[model samples]
Target chain A: MKAVTAFAPATVANVSCGFDILGFAIGDMGDRVKVSLSDQPGLRVVSITGDGGRLPLEAEKNTCTVAIQAFLDRLNANQGLDISLMKGLPLGSGMGSSAASAAAALMAVNELMGTPFTKTELVPFAMEAERVACGAAHADNVAPSILGGFVLIRDYAPLDIVKLPVPEGLYTTLIHPHIELRTADSRSVLRRQISLQDAVVQSGNIAGLISALYTSDLKLLGRSLKDVIAEPYRALLIPGFYELREAIQKAGALGSGISGSGPTLFVLSESREIAAAVAKVSEEVYAKIGLGVDVSVAEVNPIGAYVIESV
Target chain B: MKAVTAFAPATVANVSCGFDILGFAIGDMGDRVKVSLSDQPGLRVVSITGDGGRLPLEAEKNTCTVAIQAFLDRLNANQGLDISLMKGLPLGSGMGSSAASAAAALMAVNELMGTPFTKTELVPFAMEAERVACGAAHADNVAPSILGGFVLIRDYAPLDIVKLPVPEGLYTTLIHPHIELRTADSRSVLRRQISLQDAVVQSGNIAGLISALYTSDLKLLGRSLKDVIAEPYRALLIPGFYELREAIQKAGALGSGISGSGPTLFVLSESREIAAAVAKVSEEVYAKIGLGVDVSVAEVNPIGAYVIESV
Candidate 1:
C-alpha cells in the first residue's frame, strides 16, 4: 500500500476588522491526516485520534473523509482509500478546527495521488468540508490553512482568494479558554442589520489593514485591528473577554480580538518576546476567572499543509 | 505685499466599494484661488467669478474664505488678505467642487504664510470648508485634493488619512451630464442602516482594491470597484445610469461608477486609449438621451494643490 501523511496548521480568521474575509495560518498546532491506497473501491475512515471519540467515525460524516470524497469526485478517482485523522486543535474553540482537518486530509490525499492539484485549487474542495461543518461555506479559515500566511477571500461567487504579503517579525499568540461556546450560539448574537456608519468604519479599518500589510506598517496594522460589527456582540459570549483584551493590550500586544467566533482569542505582537508576554497575561486572566486555558505562541505559518511522510 | 495663486484639482469620492472613505484626485479641472496680503486688518473677498453670482462674496459664507480663515486661525496670523475665486468646476456636480475651492484657498494661504503645516496636516483645515458647504466634515475629497493621489481616511476621530500608491499608466474619464442633483438629496436616498451581509461584501471589495493598488493589478482593481451600499438606491436618481455603466464596460473601460453622488460619472481605465474610448462612449450615451455632457480624461493627479504663481 502507498501511504502519505500531511499536516495542516491552525488558522486565525476574522483578524478583527476583516470580519469574514481575512485569515492567517499559525505554527505549532494543527491536524494531521494519513491516507493509504487500498484495493477496495470505496472510502473508509480507519481511525481517529486526539478527538476523544467525539468526531464522527463514519467516513461519509467526517470532515476529513467528506473533503477527500469531494476531491476524488472532482478528479473522478475510484480507487479505494483509507483516511486516519489526528485532531490537534480543540473542537468549537473557534480556531478553525474543522478547516484544519479538511485541509490536512486533502493535502495527504492529493500527495498520495501524485499531487494532481495545486495548493490553491484544493481550497474549494476543503470548503466543501466547511459547508458540512458550518452552515455557511466561508473560505477565510480553509484558504489560509491550505495556502498558509495571510489569505483574503475577496469574493465568494467566483471564489476569489488573494494571498497577502506578511511582514517580518510578526507573531501571534492564540489562547483558548476551556469553555463551551458553540459557533451557532456565537453567531446568533450578531444583528443581521448594522448601521451604515458602523459599516463605513469597519470598511475603513479593513482597507487600512490591507495597506498596512503592503507597506509593512505594523503600527498601522495594530491601529486598524478593530471590529465594530461582530466583536461588539460576540464578546459577550466569552467570559472576561473585555478584561482579557485590555490585559493583552497592556501586556504590549499590538492588538487582540476573538480569533474566529468565541472562546479562542488571538493576540498579535511585533516580536516573540511581546507575544510571550501576551500569552502570560492571557493565562493569568483566564486563571483569575477559574477557567483553564491552552495557549500557543508562534510566528504565522508561511508554509501551510505539507506532506510529512510518503511511503 | 505678497501674493500666491494655487490650484486644487477636483476629486472623485466614494470610489464604488469605498464609500465615504476612499477618494482620488484628477487632473485638468479644478478651482483656483489667489490670496494677496493687504494692508486691511480683516480678510475680504475681492472677487468671485465663474459661479454666475451664485456663491457668497462675504468672507465667512464662502468655502474659500472660510477655509482661509481656519488656516489663519490655526497659524495665529491675523494679516489682512484679499481672496479671488475662479471656479473651474461646476457647483454641486458631484465632482468635489466645494472641496477643490477649500483646498485651493488653503494652499494659497499656506504659501502666502511661511508654510508651517505639511500637506497631510492641511486636510483637517480644508475639512472646515467642507463642513460649511456640506453638513458633514468629510475628508475623502479634501484629503485627496490636498495631498495628491488616492487617500483613504482610516479614522475620523483622530483624523487618520493614508495616501495610497498610484499605479503607472492608470487613467480616468469623468463625464458630467447636465442635471440638478443635490448632494443632500443624493445622501437622503441612502439608508441609515444596511444589511451586515452587504457590509462584508463592501469591506472585501475595499480590501481587494487596496491590495490591487499595491500589486498594480488593474483587472482586480476593476473587479473590486463595485458599490452595493449606495449605488443601488442612488442609481435610480441618475438617468441612464446602469446603461451608461454597461456601455462603458463594453468600451473596454476597467470600471465605472457615480463620481460623488450623481449626475457625474467616473470611469477608470488601464491605459489612455481605453480612457478616451470610454469618454467618447459616455458622451454618445448622454447625447442619445438629449442631455448635454462635459467630459474630460486625465491621469491621476500626483501633486495635488500647488502654487500656480507667486510674487
Candidate 2:
C-alpha cells in the first residue's frame, strides 16, 4: 500500500489593501493530512481530528476529501485514497483553515501517486476545494498555504500566481478572537460598488504594499495599509476591531488589519519583540471587551505544503 | 551675476495598471529653461520659443515662471530672474510638456539661487505649477520628470514617492498623433463609480506591475499591464488605438497603453530593436488613417531635470 502524510501552513489572505489578490503563510499552525491507497475505489474520509466536530464527516462534503476526489477525476484514474485530516487551525478563524486542509490532502495524494503533477499544477484542486467552504474558488488562501511565503494572485481567471520574497526579520502576530465569523457572511458585508476616488487610493496602496515588501520599507507599508473599500463596511462585524487596531498601532506594528474574513486580526512587524508587544496590546484590548483571544508570533512560513511521511 | 540653464525630460504617466499613481521619465524631448539674474526686484519673463506663441510670456501665467515665483516666495528672497522658455515638446500631447517646463525652470532657478532644496524637495513646487495648465496639481508627470527613472506616488497627502529601478535594456516607443486631448477631458471621460470586482482586478494588476518591475520579469510585466479602469473609457478618444496596440504586441512589445491623458501612446520592449519595430508599426497604423504622428525611441531617462549651464 502506498501512503503519504503532508503538512500545509496556515495563511492570512486579503492582506490589507490587496483584498483578494495577496496572501502570506505563517508559523507551524496548519493541517496535517494522511493519504493511503484505498480499496473502496473512491475517495473516503477515514477520520478527522482536532476540529471539534465543526467539519463534515462525509467525504463528499469535506474540503480535503473533495480535493482528493477532484485530483483523481482530473487524472481520469480509478485510483482512490483514504484521507485523514488533522485540523491544527480552527474553522473560519481567518487563518486559511480550509485552505490548509485542502492543500495538505492534495500534496499527500500527489506524493502517494508518484508526484506526476507540479506543485503549481495542484493549485486548482485546492482552489476548487475552497468552493466547498467559501462558495467560491478563491486562491488567495490556498496559493500561499501550498506554495509558502508571500503569494500574489495576479489574475484569478486561469489563475496566475506570483511568488514574492518575504524580507528577512518580518514577523507576524495573529490574534484569533475566539468568535465565529463565517467567510461567506464577511464577504457579503462588502459593497459591490466603490467610488472611483476610493478605488484609485486603494490601487495606490496595493502598489505601495508590494513595493514596501520588496524594498523593506516598513513605514511605507504601515501608511499603505488603509483599506477604504472593505474595512469601512466590515469593521462593524468584527467586535472591538477598531480598538484592537488602535492598540496595535500604538505598540508600533508595521500594519494591522482584518485577516481574511475576520474576527481574527493580524499585525505585521519587523521583529519578534514588536510582534509580542502588538500581541499584548491586542490581548489587553480584547480582554477589556470581555472576549478571549489566542495570540501567536511567527515568521513567514518559508516552506509551504511538504511531505512528512512517505512509503 | 549668476545664471543657469536646465533641461527637464518629458515623462509618461499612468503606466497601464497604475492609472494616476505611476510614471517614468523618457527621451531627449523636453523643455529648456534659462534663468538669469535680472537685478530687478521681482520675476520677469524674457522670451518664449518653439511653442508657436501658445505658452504665456508673463511670469504669473507660465508654469515654469510660476514655479520660480513659488520657490522664491518660500525662500523669502527679493531676488529677481529673467526667464527664457524653450518648448522642445508640444503642449497637450500627453507627454508632460507642462511638467518638463516647470521642472526645468525650477531646476535652473534653484541652481541660480545656490540650491537651497534637494531634487526630491522640488517635486511639490513643480506639482504646484501643474495647476496652471491642468487646473489641478498632479505629480505623476512632474515627479518622474524631476526625479528621473520610474516613480510611484504611494500617497498624495503626505507625498510619499518611491523611486523604482529601471531594468537594463528596457526601451520605450512613444507615438504622438498631434491630436488634442486635454488632461481634464481625459479625466472627465471616466465614471465616478466602479464595481468592487473591477477594483479588485485593477488592484491586482498594479501589484503585479510593481513586482514585475522589481523582478525584471518582462513577460510577467507584459501580462500585468491590463488597465481595467482608465483605458477602456479613454480608448474611444484615441483613434485606431486597439489595432495599434495589437500591432505593437505582434512586434514583440512588452506592453502598450495610452500615455497620460491621451493622443499619445507608449510601448515598452526589451531592446531598441523591438522598440523601433513597434514604432514602425505605430506609424503605419496611424498613416493608413491619414494622420501624421511623431514617433520617438528612448530608454528610461536616468537623469531628470539638470543644469545645462551654470556660472
Candidate 3:
C-alpha cells in the first residue's frame, strides 16, 4: 500500500470520581491522519490543517509524528513517510486532542506498515506523544482512545491497566467552553497533599463508581461522582464550573465534572433527552457568563482508533 | 415466639484496597446471640460467655445490646429482651468481633420481634453498636456482617451501600495472632493527612480491585491489593505482619494485608489448596515469633447473620 488514512476518537478522562485513573472514549468527532510513502529515507510533515497553523509542522515536534517515530523505532523500520494532519479536536480543550493525533498517526503508520500491531499495542507509542502534550506519563486519555470504551490505569510503574465495562444507553454531554486552561497549569493548581478524610472519601467513590458501571446502577454512580481531591482545587480555573455542575445536576445529569483538566464540563445521563437538557443548561451557564461554548452529546465509543482505507 | 438464636459470621474489613468502605463475611466462625422474653421492661443481658470475661456485659456498654436497643428504638418496640452472648469471635482481633456480636444480637432481636427489619435495614443499628466497639461508627465490618458476601459502603451520609460480586473459587485465609491491639489504639497510629500522590495511587487500586472482582481477574485483583494509608501505620503494631504478607505472596496467594485494624493478617487465594498454603505461611510466621496463632481458610460467606431456627 502506498498510503493509509486512519481516525481516532476523543475521550473523557477523570470522569468525576477517578481523577487520574479512569476515562472512556466518546463521540465521532476526532482527528484524521493521512500517511503516504516517499522515496526519501525519513519521515516528513507535508502539511497540517484545521488547527489554524498552531501545531508544529516538524515531524519531531508534533504529537502524531512523535508517536509514529516511536512506532518506527520499536519495529526498526526505515521507510520514509509523508503525513497530513487534520485536527478535528480543539487544542488544550481537555478533549484528548493530542491523544487523538498520536493515536490516528500511529494507526495510519501501522496500517501502512502492514499492521504489525494490535490496537492496544500502540498505547505506549501514543503515550510518548501524550507526555509532550501534558508533561506527565498519564494514560487516562490515550488508553481509552486506543482501547475504546472505559479504561482504568491501575498503576503506571508496570503500565498496569484494566478495561472497565461501559453500560448501554449511557450518554456523555461535553460542553467545551471557549477558554484556555493548559493541562500543566490546571494541574499546578492542585495541592501536593490532601486530608486523610478526603482521600478515604475519594477512594470510596472510585470503588463505588466502578461497581456502578459493572452493575448498570446509574443512581449509585451519580451519587459516587464526587471528586474530593482534584475538582475542589481545579474548578477555580474554570469560570462558573461549580454553577454548571449544579445546573446539570438539576437538569437530570447522572454526574458532572471537568473533562480532563478544565474549561470543558462533562455531564453523564442515561437518555439523550436528559443529556440535551444538560447541554442546554451548560450552554446557558456559559452564555450568561459571556463565554462561547460547543455542546455535544455522545455515547460510549465501542471502538477506539481505526483505519479508513489503504491504497 | 418468645426465644430466638442467630449467628453472625466473622468479617474481614478494610480488604486491603478499600480502607473504610470494603469488607466480606467469612466462614461459620462467628458470634451467636440468643434472645428471650424477660420480666424486665427494658433490654438487659441475662448472661455472657466465651469472651474470657474481657468484654463489657452491661446492656448499655455492650456492642450487641446497643444494636438491640437501636433496633427497638427504630421500630418503637417496647418489649423487654434477655440476651445471651456466645462470643465465637475474638475481641480486638480485627476479625470484626464487635460486628458479629452486633449482627447476631440484632438478628435475634428482630426475629424475636417477628422480623420487622431487613438485613440491610439493620446496618445503622449495628453501626450504633460499632460506635461503642470502637470510637468510630464506620460500617465496613457491620455491613458485610449483615449483608454477607462482599459489601461496599458507597457513602455513609445516607448510608448508601452495594453488594459486590465475589467470583466463585475465591478463598480467604485469616490468621489471628495471639496479641491485643484495640481498634482505637491501632486507629490512633495513622496520620491525620496523606499526600495527594498516595491518595491517587490508592484510589486507582480501589477501582482496579472492584473491576477485578466483577470481571474475575485474579491477577489484577492481586496487584490491586495495596494500602498506602492505614497498613503502613498499623503494620508496626502487628509482629511479623510484613513477613507474613511477603510469605503469603510467595505461597501463591492472590493478595494479603491487614484484616481490619491490626493483630490479624488476611490473604486471598483462588483455591482451598492455595489458601491452605497461605494459612501455613501465616501460622509459621506467628509460631516463629513465639505467638499463638489461629488460622482458618474460608470461602466467601454468601450469608451474614441468619436465624438458626424457628420458635
Candidate 4:
C-alpha cells in the first residue's frame, strides 16, 4: 500500500490592516495528515488526535477528508483512502487550525496521487474545506498554509493569491489564550457600514504594509499594523488585549494585533530575542489576568506544507 | 538679485483602487515658478500667465505665493521675494494644476533660500497650498508632485508618505475633456459611508496594486485597478466615462480611471506605444460624444520638482 504523511504550518490571518485579504505562515506548529490507500472505494477518517475528541470523525464532516475529496473530485480519482489527522494547533484558537488540517491532507493526498496539482493549485481545495468548516471560503489562512510566507487574497471570485517577500530576521510571538470566542459572534460585532474616512485609513495601512514587505522596512511595517475596521470592535471580546499589546510594545516588539478573530494575539518582532521578550510579556500579562495561555515564538515559515514520510 | 526657476510635474491621483491616498507624477506637462529676492520686506506677485488671467494676482490667495509664504514662515526668513507663476497645466482639469504650481513655487523658493529643506520635507507646505486651493490638505497631488513617482499617503495625522517603485516601460495616457467639474461638487456626490464588503474589496485591490508594482506584473496591476468605492457614483458626472474606459481597455491599455475627481482620465499602459494608442482611442470616444479633449502620453516622472534655472 502506498502511504504518505504531510505537514502544514499554522498561519496568522488579518495581520492587522489586511483584514480578510492578508496572512502569513508561521513555523514549528500546525497539523499533520497521514494517508494510505485502502481496498474500499471511498474516503474514511481513520483517526483524529490532538483535537480532544471534538472534531468530527465522519469523512464528509472533517476538513481533512473534505479537502482530499475535493482534490479527488477535481482529478476524477476515486481511489479509496484512509486519512489520519493530528492537530497540533488548538481549535478555535485563531491559528488556522482547520486550514492547517485541510492543507496537510491535500498535500498528503496529492503526494499519494503522484502530485497532480501544484501547491498554488491546491489553494482552492483548501478554501473549499474552509467553506465546509467555517461557512466562509476565505483564503487568507489556507493560501498561506499551503503556499508559505505571506499570501494576499486579492480577489475570491477568480481566486487571485499573491505571495509576498518575507524579510530576514522577522519573527512572531503568538499567544493563544484558553478562551472560546465563536467566529460568528466575533463577526457579528463588526459594523456592516464603516465610515469612508475609516475605510481610507484602512486602505492606506494596507498599502503601507505591502510596501513595507517589499522594501523590508520594519519600522514602517510596525506603523502600518493598524486595524481601524475590525480591531476597534473585536478588542472588546478579548480580555487583557490592550494591556498585552502595550506590554509587548514596551518589550521592544515591533507591533501586535489580534491574530484572526479573538482570543489569539500576534506580536511582530525584528529579532528572535525581541520575539521571546514579547512572548514573556504576553505570558505575564495573561498570567496577571488569570487567563491560561499557550505562547510560541517562531520565525515565518517560508515553506508552507511539505511531505514528511512517504512510502 | 538671486533668482531661481523650478518646474513640477502634474500628477494623477485616485489611481483606480487607491482613492484619497495614491498618486503618480506625469512627465512633460507641469507648471513653472520663478522666485527672486527683492529689497522690499514682504513677498509680492510680479506676474501670472497661462491661466487666462483667471488666477488671482494677490500673493495671499494664489497657491504658489501661499506655499512660498508657508516655506518662508517655517524658515523665519524675512527676506522679500518676487514670485512669477506660469501655469502649463489646465486649471480645473483634475490634472493637479494647483499642486504643480505650489510644488514648483516651493522648489524655487527653497532653492532661493539656499535649500534648507529636502523635497520630502516640503510636502506639508505644498499641502497647505492645497488647503488654500481646495479646502482640503490632501497630499495625493502634492506628495507625488514634490517627491515624484508613485506616492502613498499612509497617514495624515503625522503625515507619513511612502514613495513606491515605478516599473520599467510603464507609461500613462491622460485625456482632459473640455468640461467643468468642481472638486467640491465631485466630492459631495460620494457617499459618506460604505458597506464593509465594498471596503474589503477596495483594500484587496489596493494590496494587490502595491504587490503588482513590486513584482512588475502588468497583468496583475491591470486586474487590480478596480475602484468600487468612488467610481460608480462619480462616473455619472463624467460624460461617456464608461465608454472611454471600455475603449481604452479594448485598445490594449492596462487600465483607466478618473485622474483625481472627473473630466481628466488616466490610462496606464505597459509601453509608450500602447499608451499613445489608448490616447487615440480616448480622443475618438470623446469626439463621438462631441466633447473636445486634450490628450498626452508620458512616462511617470521619477524626479518630481527641480530647479530649471538659478542665477
Candidate 5:
C-alpha cells in the first residue's frame, strides 16, 4: 500500500465522571503521523519533529513506532513499517499529546494495511502503546483519538468503548500555559483512594454532567461539571487555576476544568462567541500571573482519526 | 381558590448506579391526590383509600399531607385546606408508592394555591414529605414524579436536579410481585459507609449507565446497569430476582433490576413489542417460582405530575 499521513485530535480524558473511561476529541488541535508499509520485516522509526528535542528517536522508546508495532503484532502479521511523527501537539502538556501520537500512528499503519480490525477492537492496541508512554493502560485519550467525538470506555477487558454523539453547537476553548508536567508526575500527586463520601459526591457530579450533556441543558451541565476528587488535588499545579475558572464561569462558559493532566484548561461553551468570551477571560486570568498561553477556540470534532495527506 | 386533583407517577429510587440520586416516573402506576381550598382554619385529611389501611390518617403523619404543609410553609402563609388521598398505586410495593402520594399531593396543592412554586422548588418539599414516610430526605422518586422523565439529582440542597431527555423509543416492563417491602425495612438492610473500593466501582458503573442513557445505546445501558453496591444485598428480598432477570434478558429485554426497595423488577426495552415480550417472560418466571405477580408493560410516560380534574 502507498504511504499515508493521518491526524488524530487531542482528547480530554477523565471528563469529570468518566475518569479513565471517557474522552472527547478536539477538531482542531492535534498531532499528525505518517506511515508506509516497508518490504523489510522489521519496524523502523523514521523521524520525530516539532517536539523541541524532548521525544526519543529510538523505535522502541518512541510512542508512535511502538503503537504501530503493537497494531501489527495484534494481527499476527509480521510487517515492517516506516513511521514519522509530526508532533503538532505539545508533549506532557495535559492535552493528550502522547495519546494522540500513539492513536495516530496506530491508525495510520492500520489504514496503510487492509484494515484488519474494527475501530473498537483497535483501541486496546492503541491503549497498550499509550501505556508504553504513560505507564498505564487508559482509553480516555485513545478512544477519542481513534473513534472521534465523545467516547465512553465502558470496559477495559473485552474492550467495550462507546462513541456518543456530541450535542449540537458544542464548542471548546482550550488554554495551555507554556508549562510542562509529565503525566506520571501529575498522576503521582493524586491520593491512591478517596473517601467514600467524596467519591459519591464526585460520582453524582459526573453522572449529572453526563445527563446534562445528553439533554443539552447547558445550565445543568455547568452546575454538574464539578470535580471533587481530581480537581482539588491537581489544581495546585497550575497558577491562577481558581481565578481562571471563576473568570470562565463569569464569561458565561457552561463549565471549566483541567484538560487531562495539566497546564491546559478546557471550557465547553455553546457557541464561538461564548468560547471567545471564555478565552478572553481565561487569557486575562493567566496574564495576571505573568504567563504566556495558547488558546484554541475549537469545536468537538465528530470525525476523528482521518487521513490528512497521502504521498 | 378552587379544588384540583393531580396525580404523580410512581418512581424507583437508587436507579442502579445512582443509589439515591436518580429516578424516573412511571406513567400508569401512581397515586391521585385531591386538594381543595376550604374556609376551614387548618388543613384536614378527609380520606385515604387503596392503601390497605397502612397509611396514617393524621395530617401530620401522612406523606401527602406533610408535603402539603411543606408547600404551605414555602409560601410563608398558613392556609386551611382539605386533602384527600386516592391511593391508586399500592403502598409499600417498592415502586415508589409513597413518593407518588407525596408528589401527587404537592402537585394538587400547588395548582390549588395558584402556582407559587416551580417544579424545581417543589422537589425539596416533595422529598421532605417522603422523608416523613421513609425516614430520610430522598428526591429520586419525587424529582421524576414532578418533572416527568429521567431525573438526575445533582444536588438536593437549593434543589439542583437535571432532567435528562429519555432515550427515544424506550419502553418499560415492571413486574410487581404480590409481596410488599417497606422502604424503612429496605433501608435497615444497608450498611452505612461502604468500602471506598466498592464505591469507586459503583460510581464507575453509574457513570457508564449515564453515558449509555445519553448515547441511547441500549446494549451499553443494559451492561452498565449492573449495581455492585445496593442490589446485591437487596436482591435477596425479591423472589426469583436473578432468575427473572435472566429470563427477561433472554426474552429480549435489555436489562432488569430491582426497582426502588424491592418486590418490583423493572425492565427497559427499545420497543413496545420487546417490552411486552419481556413482561411475558417475567410473568412466567414468577409463576414458575410459585409466586403471584402483577405485570405492567408500559412506555415511559413523558408527562409527569399534572392536574387530572379541574374545579
Candidate 6:
C-alpha cells in the first residue's frame, strides 16, 4: 500500500428548518488531509496546521486521526497510517471545521486501503470523529460533507439516509463573524423539555421545508424553513443576529438562518448574483454591528469527498 | 337555478405522526350537505341529521353552514344559501366529519353560484369552519378534502401548499371503534409545551416519511411514519391501542397509528391483500379487547372529493 491524500469541503447543518437531520455541502470552505501507510502497527496523527494552534495533535483527540482510526478498526484492518491535516477552516467557528478534516481523513485512509468502506459507512465514523471534539454523535455536518448536496439522515438505527435533490439554481451566502461558539455550548443552552404545542408547530414547519425542497419552490422554501425551537434560544449568543437576518431578507435571500451552531449565518438564494448580493449585504450588516466577518458565495456542491489532485 | 346537494368524504387528521398539518380523505365515512338559493337573502342553514342530535341547526354554530355563509358574504351578494347536512362520521372522533361537511357544502354552493372562489381560497374558509368545532384554525383535514391526495401545507400566512405525489401500490385499513372522542375532549388532554429534543426527533421522522413516500419504499415508510410526540399522549384514549397495533403488525401492516384524534386507527400496507390481512388481524384484536370496530381496506383515493355521478 502507498500514501494517499484527499479533501472534503465544510458543511452547513440544519439548513434553517432541518435541525439535526438535514445538511448541505459548501464547496469553497473546507480542510485538506494527507494519509500515508506506516510500518508501525497502530494509527498516528503526524501534524496539523492552519487551525490557530487550537486542535490537538493526539491520536484520540484530533478529529481527522480519530476518524481514520475508527474507520480502520471497523474494517478490522491492522494497518497503521500517519495523517497530516491542513485545516483551512477555523475551529469553533460553526463552519464544520472538524467535520471537514474528519471527512478528508476518512476518505484518504479508505482510498489508500483498497477502498473497503462506502461513503455511507464512513459517515458514522466521521461523526464519531466530530464527537471527539463536540462530545456527541451527530451527522448533520458529516452526512453532507460525505454525500454532498442535501442529505437527510432518516434514522441512525439501521443507518437510513436519503439524499434530496438540490433545488434548481440554489446558491449560498455564508458569513462567518470572527467569534467562536462551540457546538457543545450552544447545545447546552437548549431546554431539555419543550411544550408539546411548540413541538407540533415545529413539526409542521419541518414538513413544510421538506416539501418545499422537493417541489423546488424557492418562495415556499423560504416560508417553510423556520426554526421556532432552536434559533430563538441560540440567536442571542451570536452578535447582530437580527440585523444580519433583516439585511439578508432585504437583499433578496430566499431565507436565512444560523449555520449550525452560532457565529456563522447562512443565506440561501437562487443565483450567484443574488448570492453575491447577499454576501455584500451581510458584510455591510456585520460592519454596522462593528464585527469583522468573512463572506463567501458558493453553490451547492453536488460532489462530496474525492481526490481533487490524484497522486 | 335549482337546489343541489354535494357530499365530501370525512378525513383523518394527523395521520399518526403528521399532527396539525397532514390528512387524507376517506370514503364511506363523511357528510352530505344540500345547498339551495334562499328567498330570505344571506345564508341560512335549515336542517341537520345523522349527528345523533348533537349538532346545532343555527348557522352560527354549524360548521358546514358557516362555510357557505362566509363564501356568500365575501361575494357581497344579496343571495343566501339554505343548507341541510347529513353527517355520517361522528363529530370529532379523530375523523374530520365537520371538515368534510364544510368543504363539501362550500364546494357545492360555489358550483351553483358559478364558483366565486378557487379551491385554495376555499381552504381557509373550511379551516375556519373547523375552528368553530376545535376552537383553533388548522387546515390539515380541509386541504386534503378540498384539493385531494396527501397535501403539504407549507405555510398558512401566504397559504402556500404543495400536493405531494401519493406513492404507488399503497393501501389503507381503517378501524373505527364504536366509541366517540370529540376533538375538543381529545385536544384538552394534551400538554401545552414539549421538549425541543422530542421536536428534533419527530421532525427527523417526518422528513424520513416524506422521503420514503417519494421513493415509494413501503418498508421505509412503515419505519419512518412514527409519531413520538402526539401518539403516546393521545393513544391512552383509544381502546386496545397496544393490542391492536401489535395485531396489525403481525398481520402485515407496514405501519399503524391512531387515525386523527382517537377511537379510530389507520394502517398502511403495500397491497390490498396485505391491507385486508391487516384489517382482519386488527378486527380480531379489537374484538378481543371488547371494542366493537368496523374495518375497511381502501386504496389511497388519489382523486379527492369529486362527484360520484355527474356534476
> Could you give candidate 6's per-residue lDDT for residues B130-207 as a string of tens digits?
788778777888888877767776567767666777888888888888887776677777777766666777888888
Residue A221 alpha-carbon offset, candidate 3, angstroms:
1.0
**How does residue B226 of candidate 6 score in lDDT?**
85
TM-score of every candidate: 0.97, 0.97, 0.97, 0.98, 0.89, 0.94
Per-residue lDDT tens digits for candidate 2, residues B4-46, read 9999999999988899999999978899999999868788888
Residue pairs of candidate 3 with colliding backbone atoms: none
lDDT-based ranking: 4, 1, 2, 3, 5, 6
**Residue A89 shift from truth in candidate 5, angstroms:** 1.6
Winning model by lDDT? 4
Residue-wise lDDT of candidate 3 within A56-138, one digit each (tens)?
A: 88887898888999999999988899999999998888889899999899999998998899877888898899887678767
The pairs that clash in candidate 6 are: A193-B195, A194-B193, A194-B194, A194-B195, A195-B193, A195-B194, A196-B193, A196-B194
Off by over 4 Å in 1: none
Error of 4 at B238 (Å): 0.3
The candidate scoring highest on DockQ is 4
List the TM-score for candidate 4's chain B.
Answer: 0.98
Give the per-residue lDDT digits (tens) of candidate 2, residues A203-262. 999999899889888788888988989988788988898888888888989887788889
Q: Give the per-residue lDDT of model 5 (tens digit) for B244-307.
A: 8788878888776778887787888889999999888888888898889988887777777888
Worst 10 residues of 5 chain A by lDDT: A191-200
| Alpha carbon deviation, residue A186, candidate 3 (Å) | 1.1
Among all windows of 10 consecutive residues in model 2 chain B, the one with the lowest summed lDDT is B178-187
Q: Write the per-residue lDDT of candidate 1 for residues B95-164, one digit (tens) a residue.
A: 8999999999999989889888899988988899899998879999999999989999999989999999
Interface RMSD of 3: 0.6
Q: State how far residue B8 of model 4 sits from its true place (Å).
A: 0.3
**Interface RMSD after interface superposition, each candidate:** 0.4, 0.6, 0.6, 0.4, 2.6, 1.7
Residue clash pairs of candidate 4: none
**Local lDDT at A262 for model 2:** 91
DockQ, all candidates in order: 0.90, 0.89, 0.90, 0.95, 0.41, 0.68
> What does the lDDT read for residue B218 in candidate 1?
94
